[model samples]
Target: MLNYSFPLTAAIVATFFAAGLVKGVTGMGLPTVAMGVLGSLLSPLAAAALLLVPSFVTNVWQLLAGPQFGMLIRRLWPMMLTIVLGTVFGSMLLTGGRTELTTVALGVALVIYATYTLLAKPLGVSPRWEPWLSPVIGLVTGLVTGATGVFVIPAVPYIQSLDLDQDDLVQALGLSFTVSTIALAIGLVWHGAAPVGNLLTSTLAVISALLGMAAGQVMRTWISPQLFRRLFLIFLLLLGLEMALHGLLRT
Candidate 1:
């Protein structure tokens, strides 16, 4: 049996609860909150690994169980491919000796991404540009995942700009996170971060995330799509700024 100190246990519970609500209401954000809080306490490597399992599980629920599966698959396939390839490329970079720097970069990117999410305008008017734009988002998300085990926020605006209804948006976001989580898991194994002895924590996170999702579902009816968009972006901004300052000063 694995045991966490009381405070750590409480924190994980809280983190997962919040992560779930974010996922339920918006269709993503589980690992963002998890990594942000956990990265501060554990080695970035460990925190990253710990986040992988729950994220994978949560995305399964969002992508497969959601209402827009077929539509999302058709619309988001190109971006999904980019995410897969980019994460692989990023993970390969960690094969040698870039662990520490990757951690720092991870923290910094999280902050920047968070800030960008907050201030960015409505997405550009052209889906025609998305094919070109997607790879960039995918590449950055992959690099950040490789370095700090986080990604998603950098890709949010792109997804949001599509003006997907809630179900469609969640499906896309869920697919993104699910694919990234799978890629990161492979990367972690390559780098020896897998078979991590933290399954207990991961299990706890999953449960909390599910509960959070349920709660968010209850609240979802009350939240306008516009409100969801504004709140989500604002939250990302604050999260990003917090990460930036923390990473800069920590080292």
Candidate 2:
């Protein structure tokens, strides 16, 4: 078994707090921030597992927040299908021997994706792209999410690029995360990674995440969307770089 010290525990608490705040305010970012922080202190697999409970909880909150069940059901089917397939594929490859390689690959791809989103301008696509393109984004996001826990960053740009209004965007982010979180949890279970022993740590992390989400919601009214997006992007880039270095050097 792995040893978790008090200081590390404290750090994990803080991370969850921040992650929850981001998710509550922006309608996403919990898994992204939580995994990034936990990835630094724990094995990448553990970090990935840490996100399961919190994501499940918050995604449910997002799903029930508004009366968009019909819209979500309509648009989410394709993405859900893709994630189901991706999860099966990811489950087959997970093992102790592959952990380091998987972590490194996830870190590298996340860095590239984060850079692209941060640097590139939004594409002016027609409505035709919505059904066709969104699933592709979902497929890629699911594949990464199945392999690691860092799928949200890449997934964010695809949704943000759509030019959805604030309400639509919020609802979309909430639903996207909700579905993805469920998919990821199922994948982890299929892969035998959801042992009961993880419950204690995951519970603590979820509490912290809730606390953070509350804080973020309060702060959201004060910060503009543009600033929030930029801030999140910067945070993601830094975390990606840090993960890359850690994965390459330590593993």
Q: Whose TM-score is greatest here? A: 2
Lowest lDDT sum, 10 consecutive residues, model 2, at: 88-97
* Reference-based TM-score of each model: 0.82, 0.88
lDDT of 2 by residue, 1-251 (tens): 12467888788788889888877666777887777777767766777777778888887787677777787678667866776666546644433446666667666656776678778987664667778876777788777777776666456777777677777777777777777777777877777887665656786677778888888888889987567867886877787787777777766
Q: How much lDDT does each candidate structure score?
A: 0.72, 0.72
CA lDDT for candidate 2: 0.72
**What's the residue-level lDDT of 136 in candidate 1?**
77
CA RMSD per model (angstroms) = 3.1, 2.5
Candidate 1 overall Cα lDDT vs. reference?
0.72
Clash list (residue pairs), candidate 2: 20-212, 20-213, 21-212, 21-213
Encode model 1's per-residue lDDT on 1-251: one tens digit a residue: 14568887788778778878876776667787777777666656666767777888888887797887877777777777777777766766544455455545656666676567656667753877876777777777776676667766567767878777877877788888888888888787876766546765676678888899899888889987558756765665565565556656655
User: What TM-score would you give candidate 2 relative to the actual structure?
Assistant: 0.88
| Count of backbone collisions within predicted model 2 | 4
